[model samples]
Target: MLFSLFSEFNRVDAEDILGINADAAILVDAETGRVLYEKNSDQVLGIASMTKMMTEYLLLEAIKEGSVTWDQEYSMSSYVYNVSQDYDLSNVPLKRNGTYTIQELYEAMTIYSANGATIAIAETIAGSELNFVKMMTEKANELGLKDFKFVNSTGLNNSDLINHIDDGQQLVGEDQEENVMSARTTANLAYHLLKDFPEVLETTSIPVKIFREGTDDEIEMENWNWMFPELAMKHGTPAYKGVDGLKTGTTPFAGACFTSTASRDGNRYITVVMNAKGGDPRAARFDETKKMLDYAFNNFSKEEIFPEHYQVKSNKTLSINKGKEDQVKVYTKEAVELVSKKNEKENYQPVLVLDKKLLNDEGELTAPVKKGDKVGYMTLESKDGESIEFLDGSSLKVDVIAAENVEKANWFVLSMRAIGGFFSDVWGSIASTVKGWF
Candidate 1:
């Protein structure tokens, strides 16, 4: 079979996400990190509460690593506690010395988009709000989010910062830049959050929750994301009805931004729409998102390869050092699925490459192969290729692993296999000679 490589490996670019009217937008396959569509996706803009996604992500990481716990009581600082109680900003009312569980603060920020609550937790995790914002920026760097510089835990604008910052104190960095993120960066953040901490959906997807029970401070909060099924059923276009979280953001600067995720059949997708300008910005954001989601769901489809097997489709095997069997079968960790535009699935072809490190000079798998150890990779290549410049190095690759543990073959077992193979070869040679003579 003849294979063509994308001469340049160009990725889906601004021109590909045509008809999406938002200032910046992106549509991506969650499983593959494949950019199905993009329009000015790397143009950085204020992300508003969408910054909360990073805040929440880091908080979850802190909890998971035992740096913080859901049950621990964290007291509020004046910077985080008093900012919005007297103002009209988006906040969860807090009282000085009124400590709350980290879970309560997380829910307040995540479900309600409460800025005060978010900053409170930020302080808990990083000892200072300034340090926490640094952590968010560091994470963006680690994730390769090229167009981001996080200034604050909440995506509040400069004018709004007055409510949070007192005197000349830093709202973000000492220089005072607002939180900025590109549509591509926002979508990437959503992908990592969903991939790593799926439990967030348990809170983000909920329509409403009570922050505190049987207390005067109890606040009934509602999720602002309209992509939830309850709201989607009423507000969404037909193709966008099963929308679930990621997050929503809006500010004078951000202008009605929303990051959305949806799952249908066996595929999950992330879509981001930023800065729907002018009249009814919120509606414009949602409208643009509906169009993007509609196009994505109705047009693309997933085709699974290796449907009958988890094992790599190869003759390759790991040589056992001391086991009954001479070799062990190697397999992929999971089936590989390719997402393509409708009717284009057949063009994606699998290319399996064995890891050079796993093989000896003789091209045999080395011994001490434990089950589940990574052994090789399976990559996808377009029958008609693209530019390598835009291709993600990891997008086309999936892991190949040992199918079962292979210990060193004992002397008796090795001798037996060797003798049996020797006789079998001799018999085949003798039979071939006899047939030729006849």
Candidate 2:
């Protein structure tokens, strides 16, 4: 249902505002799915190794469902063996018919972006990379991702897999085509990944790990997401505070991209940068991402914009008919808290919308109303002319509920009210006729 809301938002470029030099980028409040800033974020482009995020998601899901196990061993397939030997790609060597546990391969795929380990996991889960790609597409749709396509599980260009792909496997686009996604959908994907599989952070946070350590297959794996404080400290990049596990992608066609998350105090932000500019694509993506993160952390603060039981200015009560009370008080069921721009608190306003199902012909609730009954919803809107858009393509809203119960009026009381209403109308009509005659 929320997927349909994606079409309503108009894409606006905010590149100049942040001096972001990239083909596409987006920044969002990870906790609330609120879009903080965006630039060309709707343009679909190659996502390279970032495709692994979906693979990681599905693998976690499969493991959770008992369809796959971390300790389960996968025998290296011919296709996997060939791809593993390709030194041109990022990989750890796998011997022919060699067996590796799901946990070992998962760490290699996640920490090192190992193409062979990724394909091995793909085949282990879906029997082939082709089937895994289908799963990725279906899962992307189920997650409400917009402007996305998955041709390979490893995010490598189809051309790279032309000779080594499994029999009967076909690519989705041209030979050069790689998995593609818009920055907005990518951010949405990350939001769901973090929300649904928070345990992923445990693996992604590892700055350095040895794949199959203490054996001949052992290889040191350094996280591609070098923006994390541990890696940044060692590599001499700006050490971003609270930076943690996420994914990065790069290719000749895709340039450089990173889907990164960071937290400060209690607030967290998800940022995606695609096709970053400058001679060093790797450094450029992180630099641009830092700019966006800096803009967010410096400008925004998590604030309780509206406290619990906050009543709307005008529509604070709902009229009740045939009840002991004339009306019932309605207020927010929960606090409306979100990451908001500091010093611009005046820009937001709460709007109330009542439920029509509970209203009678006279727009009043009939009889026995219970406290905490959901009567309406409260949504925040920009009082200023500026447009506010959420990453999920829907507005932020909270339930508005009744503050107390209202018992039905007694039969005698109802009869008396009806009689009194009938006489009042008769008297008013008679007086009007008398006045007209005079």
Top candidate (TM-score): 2
Backbone clash total for model 1 is: 15
Per residue, candidate 2 scores C-alpha lDDT tens digits across 1-438 of: 122323433465643699788988999998988898888888777799999999999999999999999999999888899899999999999989689999999998988999999999999999988788889999998998888778899989889988886656555656877788889988999999999998998998888999888988888898888887778777656667778869999998888999999988888899999999986888888899899899999999888889999999798898999999999999999998878898776788988988899899889988799999998899888887666678877887899999999999999999999999999999999999999998
C-alpha-based local distance difference test score of model 2: 0.87
Can you tell me which runs of candidate 2 are displaced by over 4 Å?
1-10, 166-173, 233-236
The best candidate in terms of lDDT: 2
Overall lDDT per candidate, in order of appearance: 0.75, 0.87
lDDT of 1 by residue, 306-384 (tens): 5523654455565654465668887678777767777876676667788887677766775667888887787777778
- Window of ten residues with lowest summed lDDT in model 2: 1-10
Judged by lDDT against the true structure, how good is candidate 1?
0.75
Error of 1 at 393 (Å): 4.9
Model 1 lDDT, residue 164, Cα: 55
Model 1 lowest lDDT segment of ten: 1-10
